[model samples]
Target: MSTSTGGGVPASRFLFLGTRAGHSIADAEYEAICHYAGLPTSRMDRVRLEEGPMPQIDLDRYAGVITGGSPFNSSDPITEKSVVQQRVEADMSKILDEIVARDMPFLGACYGVGTLGTHQGAVVDRTFGEPPGTGHIELTDAGRADPLCVGLPDKFDAFLGHKEAVRELPSHAVLLATSGPCPVQMFRVKKNLYATQFHPELDSTGLIERLQEYRHAGYFHPDELDRLTREALASEVVHPQQILKNFVEVYA
Candidate 1:
C-alpha cells in the first residue's frame, strides 16, 4: 500500500477510501480499482477507514475520491452497528459535506450508495437489496448521454450484492442506471459526485473471490457459494469497468 504523511496538500494523487477490515480483501479491492483505471497502484493513495479516524485529506491535492464497498450497511440500526462502522459513517458525512459543497470529483461503489444517499437525505433501506450475481442494468435516457456511460451499451451486466440500497434518489441527484430489482443502481450528486449500487471495479474473478470471502456474511446462502461462483464465472460483464476508467480519465 502507498503510504502518505497525513495533512499534505493534494497534488495529482487520487484518494481511495476503503472500509474493508480484512487485509487481503481490502488490498484486492484497491488493486482492482487501480487496475481498471489503468493507474499504477502508487498513484492512488489508499486509506483503510475502518482502522481509525479518517485521515485529514486535503481534497485539493487529489484528483478525486473513490470509495470501495464494505460490509457496513447504512440501513442497520444505530445500536446494531459496530463502533468502527459508526465512526466510519460519521467520517464519511464530514468528508461528503465538503465534497458536495465543492462538487468535487468522487465515485463511490456499493456501500458508497448508502453513504452518499444518507448524506443527501435519501431513503436508504433493505427494501432494495440484491442477491449476489450479475444483474441486468439499463441506462436511462439521461444515463445514455452521461460521459461516464459513454461507449457503454444501454443495457449491460454488472456485479452486485448488498443488504441495503437507496430507496429513492436524493432530490438533487440524477438517476443514471437502474436494475429491475434496484431502482437506484447509479446516480450522480451535483455533477462530479457519483455513486453506484453495483461494483464497477469488480469482474467475475473478483466477485468469486469476494463471494468466497464473504460467504458466511449473509449475502446469500452459504451452501450456494459454489453455484454462485459458477454463475459469476459464466456471466459476461465487460462495460462496467469503463466507468472506472472514465472517472480516472475525466478527473485524474
Candidate 2:
C-alpha cells in the first residue's frame, strides 16, 4: 500500500487503538505518545476499543496502527474474561489478520504483546509477568539490526508492568529485545508488525500517573503507590521513545 496521500495532501495520520476506559487516562496516554512522535494531536486518530465495537477504519487512510496497553489479560480463560475484553480481542484478531497479510506498520505495547502473541499461536501466560516499575532491556542481535531499533542503545530503561507475556515466540516471529523477567520483551512479525511488553510511549510522568490510577487495579499494592511513583520518577528512560518516533518516520 502506498504510504502517501495523493493529490499533494499530507499522508493520513496513524491510528492509536487504546483500550483504557477512563477518558482522562486514555487521552493522556494518546497525547503523550503524539507529543513524542512530533505529530500534532490532529495528526493522530484515537479510538477506545473498550467503549464499543471497533470502528470500520479504512486501512488506506492510515499510515500505520498503534495499540496501547490495557487492564485485560489474554491469558484469562474465556469464562473469566469480561464481555468487553472478549469483544475487543475478537476485533483485534480481525485487525491483525489484515495487518499481517499486508505487512502494514503496527506497534502493540504492553497488553498488545498478549493480543498479538495469542493471535500468532504463541504461548502467552502469566509465567513471566513483571511488576510495575522500570526495568533494563537489552536488544538481541536481531533487534540491533532492525530498523526500529536503529538509534536505540543496546540497553535502556523502560516503563513496564504486565500480568501476562509471551512464554514462547511464534514460529514466524523474530525476538527483538529481552528483559530480566520477560524473555520475550519485544518481537516482530514480518517486519512491520511489532509488539513490546514495555510501554514505549510512556515517560516517567506518564507512568507515575498510571501508577496512581492503577494502584487499586492490582498492578501493585495500594500502599506502595508512593514508593512506586518515586522509583519510576528516578529512572531515566529516554531511548525507548525513539522507537515510537522511528516508527512514524519510517512508515508515515
Candidate 3:
C-alpha cells in the first residue's frame, strides 16, 4: 500500500521508497523516517515497491527521495533470491540510474548500501557484515565537511544490522563514515546521492520491532532475541538521525 501525507506542496514532497513485504514493518519504518526527518505524517509520501512495479519518477516533482532498509540483499546468489526480491532490486536499479544520472537528492539507508554499492561497482559481500546492534562510527575528513554530517560529531554511535556490506568504497563515491567491522558505513555518489549502511531512523524501540519480526532471518540466532532486545534498550545511540534531518533540510 502507498500513503500520501497531505501537508506539503507537490513540489516539496519527499518520496520514501520501501521494499518490505510486511505492511506493518514497512509502516513502522516509514513513520520513523518521517519522525527523524522532522516531517509530519502528512508531508512524507511513501511507495511500497514490493507491492508493485516502481512508478515512473519525475525528479522535479519532489524535493528528494529516501529509501529505507529491506530484507533483500544484493549479495545473495541470483538463484537464491525470491522472485519478489529480484524484481525489487531490478526496480531499484532503474530508479538509481535516474537519481545518479541527474544528481538528484537522495538518501538510502541499510539495504541501500547493497543496491547503490552494486550499481556503482563496489563489491558488496559478506566480508564486512555486522551483527545487529549499536555501531561505532568515525567520520572521514570529507565526511566531517559534508553538509549531511553537519551538527554530527566526528565519532558517534548508531544502530545497525545487516548481513552484507560494501567491501570497498565505490569508484565514483566519496567515503563518508566508517566503522571497524564495516569500513564503508556511509558514502556519497556525485554530490546529492547518499547511502548509509546503518539505520538512521531506528532507535531501541525500532530495533526491537525489527528483531521480533526478523528473529529467524539469519541476522542472529533466534535464541539471542531476548538478549539482543535488552542490549538494544541499553544501548546509547544518539547521532545518526541527524543525517536524515540534514538531508531534508538541505534539499527541502
Candidate 4:
C-alpha cells in the first residue's frame, strides 16, 4: 500500500520509503519529491522499499516518512551486493528501527544520510563528503531559528551528491547546518526527526534534469558535465519554495 499525494487527509499520513524506486528518478525527479513532501501527484502510492517488497508501515499509518536518494550505500561493501541489494539493506534496517523508536516525522535525503545517519549512532563516513555541486549553504544559529529552517536564504541552493556523511552526531542529534564540503549539512533527531544532506526535493528544472540523467552516473566529472550543467542551469535559485511550505505548514 504505497501512497503520498496529499495523503488520506484526516491530518496524518505521509509514507514514502525508497532506497530508489519511483521509476528510479526523473519523473520530474519524482515530481519534485512528491511536490516537496506535501505529496500531491494524485497520491503517490508505492512504498518501494528499495525495490524489494515493502509493506510494513504502521507508524500510525504515517504522518511523515520521506526517504529518497540512493545508489545503495548504507556504508556499502557487502561483497558489492545484489541479493536485491541485500534485501533492501535489510528492509531499511527494520524500517529504521521503527523510525528511531517513534520519534517519527522523518525526512531523509541522499540515502537518508546513510540510513538515518547509520541508525542514529552516527559515524558514517566517506570522509567529509559532498561532491556534485550546488555548494554554499549555511544556517546554524539553530538553523536560523528553525521552523524547518527559518527564513532561509542566507545562502541556499543545495542538491549535493553524497558518498556518506555525518561523521559524528548521534547522541540524539542536533547540528542544524554547515558546509564547505559537508559537515552534517543538516540534522535533527528529536524534533520531528529531520535529516538532509541537501536535496530538499530538488528544483532548478529538476536539478538540471537529474544532471542530465545522472551524467554517466557519477555525480560530476564527465568533464564536469558541461560545467555542472551550466552551474545547475545558471544557479540563483538557492532553494526556497517555502521549505515545502514549512513542511506543509507544520502538520497543516
Q: Where in model 2 is the C-alpha error above 4 Å? A: 1-12
Encode model 4's per-residue lDDT on 1-252: one tens digit a residue.
223334345545466666554473734555677776566765454466655566655565556777767767767678877788788877877877877777877777777778888877888878876667676778788777878776687667676777678788877688888877787888888787777887877766777766666677655666777787777778766465456557656754
For residues 8-40, write the lDDT of model 2, one tens digit per residue: 335558889889989889998999889877788
lDDT values, one for every candidate: 0.90, 0.88, 0.90, 0.70
Q: Among these predicted structures, which one has the highest TM-score?
A: 1
Clashes of each: 2, 0, 1, 10
RMSD of each: 2.6, 2.6, 2.9, 17.3
Model 1 weakest 10-residue run by lDDT: 1-10
Residue pairs with backbone overlap in model 2? none
Q: Each prediction's TM-score against the native?
A: 0.96, 0.95, 0.95, 0.31
1-252: candidate 3 lDDT, tens digit per residue = 123333436676788999988978999999999999999877677889999987765566688999999999999999999989989999999888878888989899998899888988999999999889999999999999999999999999999999999997757799999989889999999999899999999999999999999999999999999999999999998799999999999988
lDDT of the structure predicted as candidate 1: 0.90
Model 3 regions more than 4 Å off: 1-9
Writing each residue's lDDT as its tens digit, candidate 1 over 1-252 gives 123466555465798999998899899999999999888887898889999898767777688989989999998999999999999999999989888888989899998899988899899999989999999999999899898888899999999999999987767889999988999999998889899999999999999989999999999999999999999989999999999999988886
Candidate 1 lDDT score at position 126:
94
Model 1: how far is 11 from its true place, Å? 4.1
Q: After superposition, how far is residue 121 of candidate 2 from its true place, in Å?
A: 0.9
